[model samples]
Target: MPYTAEISRVNPSCFLFLIDQSGSMSDLFPEVGCSKAQGLADAVNRLLQTLATRCAKGEEVRDYFDVGVIGYGQNIGPVLQGPLAGRDLVSISEIAFNPAKLETKIRKVPDGAGGLVEQNFQLPIWLDPVHNGGTPMCEALRRAKSLLEGWVVAHPTSYPPTVIHITDGESTDGDPSIDFQKKILAG
Candidate 1:
């Protein structure tokens, strides 16, 4: 029962995790119980692990669905952003070291089966708690569009690409959602 065995015959899919690294993300979100950045990073890491299993089972990590993550906010870094291939995602050590400013804190707990469980914490890397001002959400969207374009060009017939943009506040970059959606649909 390899991870990719089940989806080998299915079309490849790409996932673009567009994260909002805006200053407002510093606040605690109920789902994560921590800053938005920490929660997002943990989520992304879990997703990568899930996808990795599938990839190892023969699912084409890159050809099927190229994965890329773009972060925005005070200092959005594509630290965990890359292809779905094992080589692209951030290594565990990397996550422990320099997590993106927007990510929450995380720890690996024993899985009780000689493995470990990653526990999410409430710490953030780069969030600014500003009441008002600029939030570079549009910038992130634009970057996402660019990355998606390249991926779609290669796998045009593959499953529709998934671009997930996580933002906690309004866009300071103006109304880019509609246009961004259009680009995603057109692609």
Candidate 2:
């Protein structure tokens, strides 16, 4: 007699978080609490925590999911990292607190191990709706596409990639979204 055993089919998945740090996002969004930048950080941290927990449980997070965070705003450009790529995966809270800019002067804290630690994390330059000028969402999307393409090519056996593009305004670079979409889809 033949018997079948239960198996988890949660294959690996990749998620691209394309955030628009353009000036427009600075606009107040009631749901996000605080400014959009803060809201973005909150949401990202929450998502990362959830994934980390699931992964820890031998669930779909680590066994079958890779998270890529991309932030575009201010003059900081973008920050990219692959969470779950290693054991010492960076926490979402760390990412949330660590922005491209230094809010206050760097502080030094005693490590308690006979060493001193100099903290370098700074508050991110919140994307303002007026001061920053136009939104370079297109460029951010292109970067995401490149990253996704590379990830897909490298992990051919991985599950399909899901990209979550969050924006507060339309593209200032005409209609590059369609072209960008085509390029990504063709990859």
Candidate 3:
């Protein structure tokens, strides 16, 4: 049986976010009152920040995790935006330092007087809303396969990277079927 491994500075885990920025993602989500793209970007930025905080040691943040965010749409590949452009599998500290921009959002909060109070929260965004042609799930998975393959080769003893794949259920190029996975993994 395979035992669970402890996540420490010397032997840490990884997280790769696969976000779908296809045309369908431009639709406003009634539940969230925002586009899917916005929600996804917010979630990813929060995750990256949280990981960095968890790995902080004293004044400096330790590189205890490898993080990556890949957004696929018009062209399929890793997200080429903000400080993460042209980069893949960056350290936790890098993720902490490379937000595209931080915007303040005014939200209503419960006040002691039983009324609502306005609160400003900082929102970090690494990718913007991009509605383009094609879903291209196959190409995206292929890219992910390549990245994971390279990561596994480099960190053979570390825990396997966790991939959080979010899609809009559209595939224009081809289906990302089991055969696709087999083909990618086989090669």
Candidate 1 weakest ten by summed lDDT: 81-90
Let me know the TM-score candidate 3 reaches against the reference structure.
0.87
Worst 10 residues of 2 by lDDT: 81-90
Candidate 3 has which clashing residue pairs, if any?
Answer: none
Q: Is candidate 1 or candidate 2 better by lDDT?
A: 1
lDDT of 3 by residue, 11-76 (tens): 767888888888888888898799887777777777776888888878788887888878788876
Off by over 4 Å in 1: 1-11, 30-33, 58-63, 75-77, 81-134, 178-187
TM-score of decoy 2: 0.59
Looking at candidate 3, what is the lDDT of residue 186?
81
Instruction: Give the count of colliding residue pairs in each prediction.
Output: 15, 3, 0
Choose the strongest candidate by TM-score: 3
Better of 1 and 3 by lDDT: 3
Candidate 2 vs 3: which has more lDDT:
3
Give per-model TM-scores. 0.58, 0.59, 0.87
lDDT on C-alpha atoms for all candidate structures: 0.57, 0.56, 0.79
Residue 107, model 3, lDDT: 84
Tens digit per residue, CA lDDT, model 1, 54-144: 5543433333345566667664446452221222223222333333443455789999899998999654332222222357777777776
